[model samples]
Target: MSAFLADRDSARFELRFQSLFNAGHVVSFPCNAAGQVDLDALSERERDRYLYARAVVGGVFSLPQKQRRLD
Candidate 1:
């Protein structure tokens, strides 16, 4: 239940991320310890996509929880 929805959400987020990544809006997706995007490393446009992806992923996306939280 939750897992499936989570997977779906992740897929959607990945799609959105890829769209911007391919569009050259994001150079790299350097995440913090908690796996969220490291805004310090991202430009304003990249940051927007990152935040959008975060929302699409239901705010549960990260690089494996090994990175620190972005905010």
Candidate 2:
């Protein structure tokens, strides 16, 4: 793999879509430092959630935030 792709694959960051009305509700996906998600790397269910989160950004969720993974 290219260095860029390899770096993204090993990223320890996530893109978090926080619910606007719910303080504790969030949908997150593994992502690189720039908040780029690798759709091909996600499972079927996860891909669906990611798409859903993107679709409802203003209505159901806040703008996505890039966060470092603790684990």
Candidate 3:
């Protein structure tokens, strides 16, 4: 029983970690090598979206993994 519970818990933890890693990849794809958006190259609307993404990604990665959340 304990072994089964441990296995299930490990699976859940790995799933969560994979999701976060995938999200990091996605958020990373949009930015340049320096991890910054090129505001001048973007349209006004795109600039807004880029800025928002930057802030959200920055905050998420800045916090401890346990405390990371979009909210």
Candidate 4:
């Protein structure tokens, strides 16, 4: 979905990731703010925050802070 990724960028990324894997490189998966690794199991609040974060990272949103301001 456009909410997550565009097909072209997504496809390119998949190819790159596959190449890395084929070359025996390990890709570090994404983790949440609390360092949780599972995405599909995220709670409602965590899911919302995660989507906002994904949007920011993918250049779909500008949240101002370069790093998360979690103090």
Candidate 5:
């Protein structure tokens, strides 16, 4: 029971995440100092990685943790 319950805590976070805000602001599609992407650096493999992951917007999160401890 201890092993199963303890391990399940980490299982709750199987999803991986990446924040593009800083990167998106720094890079661009046509490769500019402040407003474009570096086509040369965009790998097909990297694009596929994004396609597989979930997309989030406005710094939102699902299921806020219970604030009050259960009795």
Candidate 6:
């Protein structure tokens, strides 16, 4: 793996997509500090969700927010 991927693997972060219409609904994926997700690290279902989230930004979901994992 490249250095970038290696650094990301050790970080605990998430890219969160909050629903534009819903108050508490959120979709999140594992990501690096810069909000970059490793598609190869996700399962098939998760990969699909990630792509869907990207497609719906600004329509169904607001812009993604990068946050460090609390746990």
TM-score of each: 0.36, 0.87, 0.33, 0.28, 0.23, 0.86
lDDT (0 to 1) per candidate:
0.41, 0.87, 0.36, 0.36, 0.31, 0.87
Which numbered prediction scores highest in lDDT against the true structure?
6
User: Model 6 residue 16 lDDT?
Assistant: 91
Q: How close is candidate 2 to the true structure, as a TM-score?
A: 0.87
lDDT of 3 by residue, 21-68 (tens): 445543222223223333555578866754555456544433212212
Model 4 — TM-score against the truth? 0.28
What's the C-alpha lDDT at position 44 in model 5? 83
Task: List residue ranges in candidate 6 displaced over 4 A.
Answer: 1-5, 8-10
Candidate 2 runs further than 4 Å off: 1-5
Clashing pairs in 6: none
Candidate 3 residues lying further than 4 Å off, grouped into runs, are 1-36, 58-71
Q: What are the runs in model 4 whose C-alpha is more than 4 Å off? A: 1-36, 58-71
User: How many clashes does each candidate structure show, in the order listed?
Assistant: 7, 0, 0, 0, 6, 0
Better of 4 and 5 by lDDT: 4
The candidates, ranked best first by lDDT, are 6, 2, 1, 4, 3, 5
* Cα lDDT tens digits for candidate 4, 1-71: 33233223322221111121233631222333433335554567766765555554424433222223222
Clashes of 5: 6
How much is 49 displaced in model 2, in angstroms?
Answer: 0.4
Tell me the tens digit of each residue's lDDT in model 5 across 1-71.
Answer: 23332442322322223344453331111122222223334478655443333233335322122222122
Q: Per TM-score, what order, best first?
A: 2, 6, 1, 3, 4, 5
Better of 2 and 5 by TM-score: 2
Model 2 worst lDDT window (10 residues): 1-10
Candidate 6 similarity to native, TM-score: 0.86
